[model samples]
Target: MTTPAPTALQRPDGSPLRILVVDDEQMLTDLLSMALKMEGWEVRSAASGFEALSLAREFEPDAMVLDIMMPDLDGMSVLQRLRQSGDDVPVLFLTAKDSVGDRVAGLTAGGDDYVTKPFSLEEVVARLRGLMRRAGTATAGGADPVLRVGDLTLNEDSHEIERGGTSIELTATEFELLRYLMRNQRRVVSKAQILDRVWNYDFGGRSSVVELYISYLRKKIDAGREPLIHTVRGVGYMIKAPQ
Candidate 1:
């Protein structure tokens, strides 16, 4: 049975929310970016506090995900500067520090919410949604929960797939991989990017797993039909409608 589509938060003007993600870790940023984009939000990332501050001014994001510790500058100082500049964009801090004192210091320094290290993408998305809602900058995004490319369609709420008027079955992992590709239709996504976006990094991050799944998806999605998925040699893969 299909479940209800979870409402995605959006700007009051019915535009997708813009989010800024700041972290020194590239893997974390990639993962977070993928998840945020899937929710229909525009996402930008920075690798340091300085770069984050720069982007925040120009992007004027609806909300921010900030990492607390960095080599260049700390999250506290970044928030402090933003507050002093009269930009009250809600901030959610990511910290490896789990101490009460550290968290209190972050909150006291103008952070609106926070999650500790090794946090779930769901929690971060949820917290950002809450922040935007409370700030009156966001509301329910839209009614559609379907992603389509060519004749293929995937109902996010139903977890169902169909192509060329036929039903197709996918494992959980296959579903995620396909969803990522469809979301990025016509755009090449490297194996590393797919690994970060679709599978757990803890799975040893094997590119072969990506290869194996691509084959699985190929048999299910492309066999006996015009191929929507294509491989860019020495690069990655992309999905797009056939000419």
Candidate 2:
């Protein structure tokens, strides 16, 4: 049986929530990227406090996921700088420091929420969604529980993907693109449109970004598997269940 979808909220103006993820560890950065993208949030990653500041100015994320431990500058320092610069964007601190003093310090330093390391992806998404709701950035109510097309199933809350009862592992970008297509299933989506919706303003002026990512997605979601994402001649792409 198909999973029940979330109650319909107002459409998100066809825009993905811009999110900045900062972590010194490459693996954690990549995992956070994957998890947030699965929830249809546009994500950018940074490894240092300076880079995080630069991204806050450039990307102007609606929210930030900051790791408290890093060389040269800690998450609190970064948040301090952002607040000093008058960037009051909501911040959620993710770190190994879970002490009461640490949480108090983070909140005092302008963090909206403090999450310890080894957090469940679901919890992170839930917190981010709550932050978005409180900030009045996203639709104020719940979102669709599951986004699907054909046999492919995306559990928005659980961040699980299944095809014909077989689970699939998709990278962050892949998950975001698939979710976008599934959300607009049956409608032709152009590369330009995809770039605008998926990659945010940093399309990097590269038109082929979408194509490259699409190729990557096809390898995992379609190669040696049934085709769900399709290319439309001289047009763009579309996702439809096989006829």
Candidate 3:
């Protein structure tokens, strides 16, 4: 038998990443915990949204896999509460509903990604890795540690951002999106490129996700300032210093 590939759950310094899996189903949580632990990650699970919220505060996981259709407090409520408390830990929603409306709702509600029911274990692992990476907690050390475009700055090491001498907070997904754009600086990146680089998913050619995030960045990064992010009509988007 061929040896299975290892799960990407360790930081560059060899520390195991912590992940919290929340679901009402015992078998599902158990299976997820087992698979996560097999990747050498610290795994925690909660059978209810209430327990999940409590554990989230205590565990402070690097990422969360949350089930939406839970009894009592639902995933949406849990996530909303966390956000209300200023917690921006990356979240991947697990739902039986795969409708566009459902996905949009989750994303709009601060979820980083989603996985439909009957997802492959490999796909879950991949999606979690992508979330961790975007959260800027996957790697320990790197060169250049910072990127700057005009007055806006992003420190990869600290996972902090500032614009025009003002500190700005960004969710994990937003940080990754801005980083990709600032890294490309003067180059206009197509929506397809942005999806591939930021989301690491084909998303079934759904370019609206990119548009939504760009609007988000605009409100956060460009509001009340000379816009650094520019739309290249009918093409994609670009970030560049003000002319």
TM-score per model over all chains: 0.57, 0.55, 0.58
Error of 2 at 178 (Å): 33
Q: Evaluate model 2: give its TM-score.
A: 0.55
In terms of lDDT, the poorest run of 10 residues in model 3 is: 1-10
lDDT for model 2, please. Answer: 0.78
Give residue 128's error in model 1 in angstroms: 0.7
The best candidate by TM-score is 3
Off by over 4 Å in 1: 1-4, 142-243
| Ten contiguous residues with the weakest lDDT in model 1 | 196-205
Candidate 2 per-residue lDDT over residues 46-79, each given as its tens digit? 9999999998999999889999999978898999
Put down candidate 3 lDDT per residue, 1-243, tens digits, no spaces. 111232244666778899999999999988888888877789999999999999999998889999999988999999999999999999999989867678889988999988889887766876787688767768633345667887888886688899988999888899989987876788889998788568744578789999999999999999989898999999999999887
Q: What is the number of residue pairs that collide in model 3?
A: 0
lDDT of 1 by residue, 148-175 (tens): 8889998765788999889999998999
Model 2 bad stretches (over 4 Å): 1-12, 140-243
The better-scoring model by lDDT among 1 and 3 is: 1
